[model samples]
Target: MAGTLTVWKFPTETGAETAVATVRDLRRRRLITLHDAAVVSWPAEATKPKTRQLRHLAGIGALGGGFWGLLFGILFFVPLIGAAVGAGIGALAGALTDVGIDDKFIEELKERITPGTSALFLLTSDAVLDRVLDEFRGQSPELISANLSHEQEDKLRRAFAE
Candidate 1:
């Protein structure tokens, strides 16, 4: 059987929690498969700094987003000594935060997410687009389908063939 792989595009502003929650509810009712619920996220502000200095956060991801959040919280508390330590910790956090997604990763994703580019993509390999369409209907109302160019699709086929 020929399986259709759908790369559904969505608004970059779509909240991860909301999307996941909707899918989870649908799954509970057996409307879709676990595979159909897969998700990948790119910044909504693809061209701008997202979350915070994300463009420069290749330094932060290495330290892990959580670590910096912790350091920042610690810095916020304490007293006068906290100010100095907080600054140091924040510097470390910034350095750590800058390490997650590198410039190349952002550049690649951003190019794909240019003003008229795909903002979000949720690919599923199955023959149930109708089911998906019905399930996600009105949920992500602004989400649109990214029509892959023939060249793009052909390239994909060739890559998979190899």
Candidate 2:
């Protein structure tokens, strides 16, 4: 089955970290299944964001540090490196696109996840949409982006409608 790549943005820098607990609880209850997850915390005064992959939650087929590192580098570090590295960044970005994450997705993440914000990035499947979303009500997470198949997107929309 195709897993959904989702990014949820939170207003506070620590919000994503706090939501991790809720996600863990949901997983324990079988409300959702996560293949891999990561958090990006950007402080207001900081030059860049800090990223942490949830190693403990990673399953057998989960993506490793290398994937996160490359993604984060492309998202947060590429600008600082300048056009001199454009060629390399392009190649790396192409790799990401090959896996369903396109430029539009990356650009949206860059635009939304500004300083003083935090985002939870999840690679998941088999989610009980309504129940999973209900668990995050307290945090008020904004669904920034999601790469889901047509059927999955329809299911998500229906879940929200109800």
Candidate 3:
């Protein structure tokens, strides 16, 4: 099945969590199929960062979970230290290219998703776009990136941008 990976950025961590909760509702209604998802948040007063991965879809062993773990580790965890450590993580990120997740995606996310904000990384298939978007009618969440066809991507961009 064809899958789409999208990142939705919100002004606040709670907003992102609310969006994710809506997605869970969509899933419950059988409007979408989610292969994996992750939430990354950086609260303004947080002494520590917060991240959550939907483990229900991870299944047995470490395949899906490990992928998100490594991705988030490079994106969130490694930066707490020095440039030297970041260099090593950069190398490790290059290796992830084989799995269709690359350094560019991570870099774009890091640059766009600022502190005091949160983002939802969604891996989904067979989604009812119209209905799903309807759930977000009042809110304007930035569409960071999506592995989608030009036409479909443009549609989603316009929808959310509206």
- Badly placed stretches (over 4 Å) of model 2 are 148-162
Candidate 3 structure quality by residue, lDDT tens digits, 1-162: 455777888888666777877888888887888767788888888854588886664322213555666678887788676899788877767765544556687788878776788887777778766776788766567776556554543333333221
Residue pairs that clash (backbone atoms under 3 angstroms), model 2: none
Question: What lDDT score belongs to each candidate, Candidate 1 first?
Answer: 0.38, 0.81, 0.69
Residue 45, candidate 3: C-alpha displacement in angstroms: 2.8
Best by lDDT: 2
Top candidate (TM-score): 2
Backbone clashes, each candidate: 14, 0, 0
Candidate 2 vs candidate 3, TM-score winner: 2
Task: Please provide TM-scores, in order, for all candidate models, with all chains considered together.
Answer: 0.34, 0.87, 0.75
Task: Output the worst ten-in-a-row residue range by lDDT, candidate 1.
Answer: 52-61
Residues 89-157 of candidate 1: C-alpha lDDT, one tens digit per residue: 545544422333233433344344333222322322333557766766665533433333444434433
Please give the range of 10 consecutive residues that has the lowest summed lDDT in model 2: 153-162
Model 2 per-residue lDDT tens digits across residues 9-97: 99999999999998899889888888788999999999999999998987656777877887898889888888978678889788666
Model 1 stretches with alpha carbons more than 4 Å out? 1-4, 15-17, 36-38, 47-112, 115-127, 140-162
